[model samples]
Target: MDSDSHPAAAPADDKTWEELVKNVLRAEMMRRGVSYAALAERLAAFGITDNELNLRNKVSRGRFTAVFLMQVLKALEVEWVHVPASIDDAARKGGAQALAASKRQP
Candidate 1:
């Protein structure tokens, strides 16, 4: 009876959510002109040890956790978050495919 179990429910794959979060993080980094090394340095000051390689791989693959996302945003001094009002149909299609694939497995 869960809403997500319904036939018409949209895809909510981890990959999709990760990509969504990664996109937001990248945009914020760009806006602040914060390079990987610089961001790492900022985080280090707060006792985090993220380096350029970790940042590159993590963000590029969009496989990081929500806590990491919040840390990055905090290091960037981002006081607000925003979700785009529109998304491309192509992205939605991809998410749906991923969701279907996930459901087919055990």
Candidate 2:
């Protein structure tokens, strides 16, 4: 109810995007009753080789590449992901910030 509690002022940083992506993937997995081992097997059907432990680590870190995200979604047979516009905007901003930061790190 208070302005300080609003997410609009949240920092659009890597951590925000990481948490968002992690939550989305985990929620999807829960929705479909899919475990890490089961997900690994499903990915194998599509020629993606990943063990349950690796999958767990990746999802836990929430720092995987977009290609990996697509692979997992495809393996899950997910047609689409429904992200709120505000969240999507924030994630995009976060991505841009990350890219900019990487560019400056050299």
Candidate 3:
């Protein structure tokens, strides 16, 4: 039987993954003082257009493709750290809740 075909192991919350990746990318960019424009230019050299970068930046939740994450990591010149599945889940849930709260008007 196919592993994914089983009902017990559904997909992990994607919103969490997107949020976590976004946070990590943002933090790394900030730490290196790399502006979006600068990153855009660098990515452009690699044939990753500004529009694509913007879309990646806008992803709020979902499974982050390894290729996409690696591209960003390469642009940032950072090593990848493996995060536990539980941590990713928590981060995604927390990020989603925070985003929802921030969108609410007073």
Candidate 4:
């Protein structure tokens, strides 16, 4: 049984999680038809002051902090987040790679 014969599954890296969160948040925003301007207003209601450009940059970069995520979710009135049964499925369906591919299209 050579170790090289069967490679083990690689752990989920930070980028994967970041992209997943980014996709989820953006999707939710899209679903609710909430623009960055609108979202900024909603967040302000929670005492989370952030401009539209900053929010867009933060979300597009997918590097926001957990506290920021909580604030956004709360502002969006998100009761629950849907999790895929497997991370692989999520990556395929709503991961950074998928997001990038979609952006490249016309």
Candidate 5:
């Protein structure tokens, strides 16, 4: 994915980490113009058979494992991923705020 298309970086803190991972995958999908069906098809070639509905649910929850992440990345042809050694204070503060706001909801 192009660097410009990335959402502002944030720390995958205790609460917001799942969302961060989910957004990263979703952004990559969006960048490749990959639909759930297309992803399902690609995975099928590797003997994985997650249907569109399952894939959608999995991506939305963002609670999948590292193996799942790799499978999706491989299927999507992601060459590499970056990991920030540290997140800046502003981004961490924003992530914390977002996580708190989410928990206070009905």
Candidate 6:
């Protein structure tokens, strides 16, 4: 997807790295006007089945593997942001805070 077409980058908050990444994917989908079904169809071209694609899109921790993430990025036509390399110290701290918050949630 064209960088110009993407939504304005939001400031990273107290959200886990995974949550932040998932939010980015959701935001990109909205910006592209692509439905989950359409994304699944595109992933099918990469041999990712509907059920598997659906699970991946759900953003459950264990459900999202590295390969799955790569496929999702490819299907979404979004620039792949490498987590470890791209996340700054502030982002990492925010993610840690988010993780702590989730653990405290009842």
Per TM-score, the best of the predicted structures is 4
lDDT of 4 at 19: 62
Candidate 3 deviant stretches above 4 angstroms: 1-12, 51-64, 82-106
Q: Report backbone clashes per prediction.
A: 0, 0, 5, 0, 0, 0
Question: What is the alpha-carbon lDDT for the whole of candidate 3?
Answer: 0.58
User: TM per model?
Assistant: 0.68, 0.70, 0.54, 0.71, 0.66, 0.52
Candidate 5: tens digits of C-alpha lDDT, residues 74-93: 99998865432333431343
RMSD to truth, every model: 9.9, 12.2, 9.6, 8.0, 10.8, 12.0
Model 2, residue 32: C-alpha shift (Å): 0.3
How far residue 17's Cα lies from its native spot in candidate 1, in Å, is 2.4
Candidate 3 per-residue lDDT over residues 6-29, each given as its tens digit: 433334765555666666665556
Task: Give the candidates in order of TM-score, highest first.
Answer: 4, 2, 1, 5, 3, 6
Model 6 global lDDT (CA atoms, 0 to 1): 0.57
Model 2 C-alpha lDDT per residue in residues 1-106, reported as the tens digit of each score? 8866655455457787786687677766765788999999999999889999999999878899999999998888878675533554425534423322332211
In model 5, the worst 10-residue window by lDDT is 97-106
**Which parts of model 4 have CA positions greater than 4 angstroms off?**
1-11, 92-106
lDDT at position 5, candidate 5: 82
Give lDDT for model 1. Answer: 0.67
| Global lDDT of model 4 | 0.74
Tens digits of per-residue lDDT, candidate 6, 10-101, equal: 55653555555665455556556777778888888899887645555475342366787778778888774433323443144345333323
Model 5 residue 70 distance off true place after TM-score fit, in angstroms: 0.2
Q: Using lDDT as the measure, which candidate wins?
A: 4
Question: Counting only residues 3 or more apart in sequence or on different chains, how many pairs clash (N, Cα, C under 3 Å) in candidate 2?
Answer: 0
